[model samples]
Target: MAGFLLWLLLLVFCWPLALLALVLYPIVWLLLLPLRLVGITVSAVFAFLGALLMLPARMLRGRPV
Candidate 1:
């Protein structure tokens, strides 16, 4: 019984720490998520556009565009 109560008390105290970590995850992700998304989008857009712009030149060279 004493061991059971100690286990229960440990859980009661530890649960909040776990809960706080869970709650903070979204906030941390939200803060950094946009920068990651925007970086990917910008890089992709630029790479695609660069490829398009270079395609004609590549074709003129009789190489794979």
Candidate 2:
């Protein structure tokens, strides 16, 4: 696509910047890893609580108490 071609041209012309970003990307990801972990933990806890709240209703349906 045109976007890919443009990106390729940019990479060719700006390789040093690209390389710098490549080296720093992982470090930045590592620095933000704890935030990602906290988000995941919060999402999992909410899902668990929802499932627990739904359990009684599921059992009352008599489908498989």
Clashes of each: 0, 0
In model 2, state the lDDT of residue 64.
58
User: What is the lDDT for 8 in model 2?
Assistant: 73
Report lDDT (CA) for all predictions. 0.84, 0.87
lDDT of 1 by residue, 1-65 (tens): 99667656755889775667667879999999999999999999999999999998888899655
Instruction: Give the clash total for candidate 2.
Output: 0
Over the stretch 1-65, how does candidate 2's per-residue lDDT look in tens digits?
Answer: 99667657767999887777768879999999999999999999999999999998988898753
- Listed per candidate, the RMSD to the true structure in angstroms reads 9.0, 3.6
Assess every candidate by TM-score.
0.53, 0.73
The TM-score that candidate 2 achieves is 0.73
